[model samples]
Target: MNMNEKRFEEAKSKIVGIQRNREGIGTLQEKTVHAVLKNYYAPDVATHEVSLHNYVADIYTGNEIIEIQNGNFYKIRTKLEVFLEEHPVTVVYPIPHTKWLIWIDETTGELSKKRKSPVTGSAYLAFKELYRIKPYLKNTNLKFCFPLMDVEEYRLLNGWSRDKKKGSCRYDRIPVALFDEVVIERREDYLQFLPYELPEEFTSADLAKSAKIPSQTANLVLNILHFMEVVERIGKSSRSYLYRIAKDLG
Candidate 1:
């Protein structure tokens, strides 16, 4: 690893170690966001790294950005509302009521527990907030997506050692697979070895630095990728998810 990467990982390990679950939510969210972008982004647009204080964003190519808020849905919406009004951009929010279920390998097919879905409450809020944005989306052309996950397929491939709380496997086998299956079109920027997009074993902090995306977004993107079949979470004493390209892509 490079000097900056090593330093960041060392520091982040201490932080993740200290707080574990409480602090992990942000990382999880960020990972998921990145995964989605990797799956959907187009190649022609030039991408760059973005970072703020303790947070990093995935590779961003365009001048305008649309941030999807799941954490503090209302608060994030409010912030985006103001920003979208001031800038020439489109901000999209996933509906909270859109339900997702987990699929387990066992015959019973147990689903992962969901906290709060955004499909219902957030849509109204997003609409109201969009009005505050000076009707930007009305006249502008942009890309916005809120795709659904086949939660059943992901829930079944659960590699218990993935994370402390057992999230989807974006870290190891899932993200890699998703890259080809879902995000293959946008893999140009992150493809280190042609097919691979992200680092194989990176700390939350390391990812935060490299992607220039927030830690929370990174975590979210990773989990979503896990659900998509590109990575796997390793269950262990110091639970950490491993990012990987699925060997089965053959």
Candidate 2:
């Protein structure tokens, strides 16, 4: 949970330089967050934006493909299926463990108060995106790397609504610190993500309560758990499917 102070400062310094170099284009922009992390992880790998099996990957080592997805997993589901058959793929997802929001004024060019967002994220947040690619979770060649980070989000006014500040577009997300990473290669690795005190027999409702997450998120996590075979459908609890941890997982 603790990030290296020295490395984080260096990364932030580098991002400042990147932002300076890319100032004031406004409409068009560079992929600063993705580019910086890519370089940080794999500096030696120069073959970025690579073509493999007719699919374009973010970065490629000679033996593996790295896809940086800061948005949605569903967008790359088809590409993952095609590439996983022939090459190992690591999906690098960055979750903002802690976030600060910065809003800029369009007309006056004034920077508003920089406030910390109330949302604090965890490794479990990755499941939100993983739900869309549940079927590919158990693939031998597939792996997920979630970098838990502290980020600064910069927003600009869109000028369309009464609440100008609220109707802004998120223009940049600068990774201030990389606290830790959760890497899942095998289905068993997912066990650590689950709550230690999950009931012997539980539904999504039970999981939501046990894990202290929303029912919607619990449902998504359960879907992935079921797909990865960590849990199974034992029976039905009214409209909900009841689940129990697999014996192998237990």
Q: RMSD to native for every prediction?
A: 19.9, 3.0
Q: If scored against the real structure, what TM-score would every candidate get? A: 0.29, 0.86
Q: Write the per-residue lDDT of candidate 1 for residues 72-101, one digit (tens) a residue.
A: 444544444444443333333333233343
Best by lDDT: 2
Best by TM-score: 2
User: The CA-based lDDT of model 1 is what?
Assistant: 0.36
lDDT of 2 by residue, 61-83 (tens): 88888899996899999999899
